[model samples]
Target chain A: MAVTARSRRVKPAGGFELAAWYFMRISGLFLVFLALGHLCIMHLIHNVESINYNFVSDRWTNPQTGYIWRLWDLTMVNLAILHGFNGLRQILEEWINRAKSRVVLRTGIWIFAGALLLLGNYAILMFVKDADYLKNRRDASSDAVTVRADVDRGASSRHPAAVPAFDVLK
Target chain B: MSVYRRGLVSRLVEGLRYGGGAGQWSWLLHRITGLGILLYLVVHIWDTFLVIFSPASYDAIMGFYGGKIHGVEYPLLRWAFRLGELGLFASVVFHAVNGLRVILFDLSPIRAVGAQKELFWAVVALFFFIMIPVTFIVIHALVAEPTPVAAAIVFPRNFVQAFVH
Candidate 1:
């Protein structure tokens, strides 16, 4: 491949675009682990049916390991959102040639991404389990264990026993 | 003279017809999966945000996922969402694995031209290797509560069953 004058100039002048390219690869490497691990934990290891507000409360409020999860979620949110939006931006740039429309669309994309990032981070950082909810969650957590056991035993009728606990939480 | 502006759909159709090779297909899939995940991420963030501002609403929203809220059951909706989760899982796995292949080609010391096809096939193999067990687990979990006999039919008792149980 011949390196034309334009191609050579890109290295020195591409500045932000160059940085965005490198960021995509680096963050993508990090997310491969972070995201797949998240999927395994949330979807594979634990049934989605088992998740609810109390589940989130329990995970985020645990005394010993909550902070670790918070940090993990924080990093995943920032990296994943930025990498996704940047990739979207690249796609849009390739497809949309008009300069003014491109600028508008790019700004809109960032605004949406920025707002989501802020909201997600705030939810993680500002979460505090109320005493009443915490106490109920503790009780429900034990009930959840029992529900899992029953489900494992092929006792379909026992499944609804888990509903009242979620009802109480609601 | 009127100018005919090419839209994104036309451009995409044209690109599809061009038929470069494995590289083009991989690039197209990456774009698609990336977009799907991003769309889900936006919804996920908003839903989680509800937890902080409205706990009751959060629990109610989760009920839709589980097929019940306040004692009402929507078994069909739950199945639909579970299937959607399976699709999302497939998308995430492919994107992650293919992204790794792209990274290796771009950043690694190895020469990419000779090995690109092999790397792509390796990614496909790994994707299925991961998804097969995962699909079983998800379907098992979905049917376990409603029809234990069917769940058993879907997933025979084995070591993997023991792990999940």
Candidate 2:
């Protein structure tokens, strides 16, 4: 008698899954380092709350300073977008069945992610070129300062300047 | 002490192999990196927004990263910055490659299980493939040690300038 072959079920290997699993642990470790250094420098050491418009204008005015700032900015943008998109992709895989509509949904989501990344990068690049806006800002600030000084010196005090008074029923 | 009972480590390995499908593992990693990146972003933005508020604060921030001084004798800040750069580099590369795996899965015609398995190893391969030069540059930039006396003496001025610069 001939024996029929019995099929055995084989489980899938850890595809990108294992690597991804390891990535989280590794990235988490690094993030702890980056975050602490970042906080210490930004808040604790310098206490960045003292920053203002001229402060930014002066900082960006330096080429090296501008470059470093852009580097950090891009790094943040790229990492955040990639990580968020990948996470969203995982969610889709785990939850949605692999149907046509689901694939389309994922594609659409990825496109949106791409768009957001591009927009963010563009905005950061443009932020450095706002010198005109900065000048206008300076003028406005100076006017405000002058107005405050006048007020402090008693602009509305008893001897008001030969100010024109509005007449009713002229 | 029971012969029939398995240890915790063995149990975890078994669980990952069985309960944790390849896809699940990758998904877990994606979430981890995702959250890490998000956390980094919040602090990054907050710190950077300083450029908008104060120039001195910004300079102080940059200067901290510029170099590290140990008393008046040694500068050790470059090493720290290198370490940070390496971390950021790794994060971006891993996330980007893994993201590609995700994109492929979404686009591929393969079954769910098959896609997961294929992408897992693919991600690993791509990660190292991209990391080679990055690792090299980072290590070269960061690690510092005293030059041998003979070598240092032979080119004292040059060596001193090279290291300092």
Candidate 3:
């Protein structure tokens, strides 16, 4: 007896699913570099203990290379967020069978992702170094001993007990 | 005709028991890690946003992440969060490597079908190769110095105070 063969015709890829599929691969390619580089810088080159308001301000507000850092961050925020939520959308599509629920959830994901994207972009674009904070640094720079004392005094006075734990750990 | 629906837990259990080879396991882990990272991404954006919203508040929150609140230290919580970051790092490394395998398979399904197992192993190898040294550095950083916390502060005692004051 001979067995019957399954259908061999290929379905042409198009529509939202196709676009989404392409988007994942492309965005993922960029993220492999963008994200891994970011992790390397944050986790490997410099540990989290070193990161603080000053570190961020210096990186984002430096006259020489601030724009490069900002653009790097902006690209990372957009690609990573979009890529992540799109993956979520795919997962939801797989699990949720109800049409109405799927619609609501999809809309909710987009709205939520959109809001985060907006906030991230705004933060990157609008960030300005605090002048008062900078002035404190500038004044303290004249003397190394005074710098440490002044910063400790200033930080504690401005924001009581808000000093980072690294001081104690040190 | 009658239709029967199975619960999510049962389906997951069944999937776990069924032998679908490395491909299936990789697919499952991809989804798991992808979801985990997505969850992190949401909070990360918000935390970074706080930098502009209030700089002092941001620093205070960062202090809390470093496991100090009101000048008090929690070593246990700090270590726990650091380990969690390690896990996050592992997940990201795995997800990224496995994602490349997926892209490879997609690029040439006919050729890749035979190499799926090899591709999976390659992904695993790459993940470890990248993670081993990085893991050492991370752990060394944690032990040698009191590394600042990069993870979330679930209880925002200082976070709230930064806003109030």
Which regions of candidate 1 fall more than 4 Å away from where they truly are? A1-13, A133-170, B1-5, B108-110, B146-165
**DockQ-based ranking:** 1, 3, 2
What DockQ would you assign to candidate 2?
A: 0.04
* Tens digits of lDDT, candidate 3, B118-145: 8888999999998887777778767754
Quote the lDDT for B165 in model 1: 39
Interface RMSD of each: 6.4, 19.8, 10.2
**Model 3, residue pairs in steric clash:** A49-B148
For model 3 the local lDDT of residue A133 reads 68
Give candidate 2's error at residue A21 in angstroms. 21
Top DockQ hit: 1
Interface C-alpha RMSD, model 3: 10.2
Give candidate 1's TM-score: 0.80
Candidate 1: tens digits of C-alpha lDDT, residues A1-170 = 11331242233246888899789889998998999888876776555565667677777877767887888899999999999999889877766779999889999999989998899899999998766764674576566634332132222444322222122221
Model 1 Cα lDDT, one tens digit per residue, B1-165 = 233347767655666765567877887898899999999998888888998988777867776776765636677987899999999999999999999888777665358667878998998999999899878878987886532222233334532343353
